[model samples]
Target: MSNLKPEPANAPDDPLRRTLLKGAGILAAGSLAGSALGLAPAARAETSAGLGGRLRGVQHFGITVQNMDRAFEFYTEVLGGTEVMRDGDFFGDRIQNTLLLTEEVRAVRDGVNPVTLGIPDLRSGAQRLDVRFIQFDNVVIELLQYRDKEQPTGSGKAFAPAQDLTSPAFPRAMHVCFYIRDDVDFNQFVRDLEAESARRGMSNVKANRIVRATTDEQRLGASLDSNTNRITEGPSAGWSLIYCKGPEGEQLEFVQVQGHAKQVFDGAYESRRKQLGA
Candidate 1:
């Protein structure tokens, strides 16, 4: 998945942050690394009270869908995500009320296009939303079905280039990723993704390799290491990432950090729990 920012130019030289960066790759997978690292020292300086810090870690990913049952089948039957919690009515009152609170929603209701504000196509008529929360390993996935409204129709194709690791967009949140355990059959997982995409008639489900683990210098537009930025140091040394598109055009990443799960998946989890006294 996307929604991650590049590393900052001026991050403090805290030993703890350095250590965490080595293990957690500067920030969590879907985090704004630059912003997080930039504000970390300031957060520390201003907040010494209990449980006071920048965000601990990611909790879940949310997405709006057109069909609840179809999306549920793809996530549950295909990806094997376990259902955790779900509560919503097909009427969409709660969801519409929540959306109406946002400036983008208001602008759309005024019959103005909102693509620049990241709110594309104002849907007319009743807006309905039902939700399904699923857990894939440690990450929680939220699937929302928003319907009964007029939305710009599409050919149901995803065209964004996959090579752009950072999918720079208006609402920068681009994708959701899942960790592939060291013991899992990697080939089978890839096959499964391909099969699911084919089943849904989406041709965008192809795998792309992340040749290098991102570095702060790289974030500044430095040339990649001649060796192709292969993981040579840190917890993810020698690791690789592969990604694909889901049925409804959502980017899905499956990371393979050989020998162990990335600290972002396992370690950051503990850190967040400790931060929350869980």
Candidate 2:
């Protein structure tokens, strides 16, 4: 989420890139297919487009957590992610200044009365922002823990395990989804998730059914059904998925996209483009 570069406009266009853009509208939709690098000359090339594309697809998924160690273990040890970088005690005068913390905010966090306060101090009550980056395939997960900070009221509790976070009513509610290898067995993955949940002593960490699109279903397109935990229709149709809760009750999804998933998405994108008269 930090040090992100800009997208290049002068990058030479490739046929595949053009085709993908014509189909999906945004590179992110097909980024997993390695189409994001189409603007660059080679893999990990240092071209401006390459540098920009790295920032474009997905640099990292940031997660605020109560305990960094627990989150790290859950991500790395349980979920088979690899730790790449860590920044402990990562806060400085410049960093604090960049955040532009006002005196009122600092006073509340520092446990001081802000109303009667005369001096305008802008330093944050937080001492350090401990952060760790975990790599999982093409994505990076940023696990952050705010240390020595005064937490607001009712902020101490983790997300409710049974909360319907996928509901459309909760606009900000979200889940991190991953694309699993095509050949891996979906049932086995579900079993592994169950085992991990039990091993971690998480009673609510359950895996949902791996929904695949079938012509027999009522819905004809790839759309998510939050209530049913099903992908009823669309490019993800026929693609299997499993949902589970992370260590901090964050929603997570693993999608099997090796088969007709791409075709489904491509068709959906193309349809939208046609409808829009693009």
TM-score of 1: 0.53
Clashing pairs in 2: 213-238, 221-233, 221-234, 222-233, 222-234, 223-233, 235-264, 235-265
Task: Report the number of the highest-lDDT candidate.
Answer: 2
What are the lDDT figures for the candidates, one per model? 0.49, 0.52
- Please give the distance, in angstroms, between residue 28's alpha carbon in candidate 2 and its true position after superposition: 16
Residues 177-232, model 2: lDDT tens digits: 87666676666666666578668865545555434544423222333332133344
Off by over 4 Å in 1: 1-57, 90-97, 104-125, 149-171, 200-204, 209-235, 259-278
TM-score of each: 0.53, 0.55
In model 2, what is the error at residue 159, expressed in angstroms? 15
Residue 88, candidate 1: Cα error in Å is: 3.4
